[model samples]
Target: MEAVDLTAEQRAIIEADASDLAVSAGAGSGKTRVLVERYVQLLRECSIPQIAAITFTEAAAAEMRDRVRREVMSDPALEQHRALLDEAAIGTVHSLGLRLLREHPVEAGLDPAAAVLADDEAELLRRAACIEAIDAAAEVGGERTRALLGLGVYHAGLQLPRMVAQRDAVGAAFAAMGAYSADWPSYVRATLEAHYEPRQTAIRGQAEEIAWQIRRDAGNVTERLAEVAGAVLQPLTAAREAREWGDFAALLAEARSQTNLQSGGNAPAAVNVKGAMKELRELDDDAGKLPAWNEHDEPALEVLAGLRALFEDSVRRYEAAKQAQNALDYLDLELGAVDLLRDHPAVAAAVRGRFLHLMVDESQDINPVQAELIELIAGGNGDGARPALFLVGDARQSIYRFRGADVHRFPAQQALV
Candidate 1:
């Protein structure tokens, strides 16, 4: 067997400066063949035999590895360099990221047994948040931030941060409604529709009804709940902080002294002290209003138990929502991973040092995060030394937009060299 021959252009491509080169060859123009020859050349010519070739797919990496082995073993001239070929690393960018992430999990501040976190994890967090929101709203009243977070969590696919930024845009749109108007509503409404797409109409109606009811029942949800809870808790909390232990006694007595203290029950308490009292009461007149847990033949206990269960459920949801916020989202993958590489010199050095050649098969499709990682691996060489930059991709083939890959990244900086 003989070594595969490279055409004149392929020869130029292979022998070109692998240190920093971007071949914007069109599709089906033998770009891969050029890569194979270049890789073999690096093994044969370049003393630096550590080849870390980043491919677009696992299959591509496999094929390249196979080609290199065939080219190395078949040719007597190159057979001596077969050992160098074995040291080559060729794989997808994702595999590379995972490798780096795994090697430096602690440095990344990631759990040793951290899961990639399925989309369901986000949904679980969102559902948990929603449940808490309903309960918190019932007991202590709703929070806009919490509501937004709940909506955002539930709609993880929508990219809440982006949607939130668009909220300002929607506000601007709302302001300029007479002009740039379309099939969109106020940002809030759009969020409502987008967030509640499954129950779009129903959720919208439900949220609207809840909003109106909250307003109607409490007459200004924010002020009512805060004012009510603040007024009561403020006095108690302030009194306690001020060492007014007697105030807490009075606060306790206020509840203990009141009879049919259902005075606050005209509609509902912005806070749930009335219901709390109702549940705490020894009354049996309204068996229907008894708590779920208390409903076991013991009329008074039923009311209290049901109320306790509901409140407990709400509080539990709130806690879950809080925890979900820390879970990894897609953005976490990019941002967190990049942060890990940059912050951990040891891990970064390990990867950057292990890979002598940083070959990105599709430079154009690289995101800021991916590009940043490449730069990190390349030791900020940006087309310099250490892991010699070997990028090959056509600007035209860079079709990915969501991962931050855009036409601007190509030939944008002096890295073009």
Candidate 2:
């Protein structure tokens, strides 16, 4: 109704009828006004009452809806469209996902009553399992197995529940800054590249050298066996021979009395070192699956497994609850929306068709997933055809890595511009 100061270039981009579109609205660049104008256009100019306005954050969505509502209340013409504005779908990606999940839980193979898993609970279960493996492996040899057992022992000794404060501090610090909360796997990969990979190679090389020395130490077992072949019933040499010649700790231990009778006074004190090593290895293999503190073999594997199962059951409950929640973190909203659009292409396309006049604020905060979701809805803008998108965001204000927001998406959008 009333013209606001806008460059002809801005007006052209906003009014363009394209299949796909992206607008790079810098901060304080009338981005919200652009969004409101587009909504008004759709309702008044395009006569589309049914529209969905999605934003990265619930706060942003609420802000936009409020401004639009304020406009509707003030303008007599828009006042008639106020009811339609009220009916318009406006939400964060996660809110939308939860809404859909509530409507279609069957599709996700999740019960409507499920819960979200708490990290502490998951950590507890993992620790219990790890400790069990370590205790079991204590009877074995080798630095690697020892290290595995040590992890279990460490877990057992910890007071995990008491460290809730520390855990929250860590989470807060991470969320306040850093990409670890944004894309965990990518962050881990970066960490490995910077620290672990080179160290791992060095450790492996050292292990090989140690293995060769162990083998050479093993050669003397046969000569010692010959010297004490008769005097000792089950010589240390024989025990060493059994362990070295073949993987036979259990085989050597069976009927120690019989072996002593056959050779006369020797049965090298029946130590199941090899069997312990095997058990240690089993724990080592499972340590990661278990907890960090309970990284041991002293605890029984069965006990650990049972505790782990309990923890997992709790975890399952927690996860289900979290998913069922109507609320979500910023990233969850984007991902959920992307999934919804991807799964229900027809519904998305129908929505997009109605919004040939879409405007987005905070374009810089849009991550890859959100970008894809917009693309799916808008079609391909640079190719040129309807409901072109006008996005306004200041790259400097684009500091939401905790929600996986990337500045890179802005550059890609720039090419389209």
Cα deviation in Å at residue 315, candidate 1? 20
- Cα misplacement distance, residue 323 of candidate 2 (Å): 7.0
Which window of 10 residues has the lowest lDDT sum in candidate 2?
255-264
Best by lDDT: 1
lDDT of model 2 at residue 255?
Answer: 18
**Backbone-clash count (model 1):** 8
> lDDT of each model, Cα atoms only?
0.53, 0.48
lDDT of 1 by residue, 378-413 (tens): 745333336677777788887666445666675652
- lDDT string for model 2 (1-417, tens) is 255576677566556553445566566666766766666655665443445566766678888788778767788876667666666666654454555555555543436664433335445543544444444445554442444354454553352222221233333434443432235334434544455445434433432342333233333334443333222223323443442212222322331222222221223321222222233333223322322212242343334333333333333443344454532333333455566656765556555555554455666776666677666655543333435555567777787664456877776655544
The TM-score obtained by model 2 is 0.46
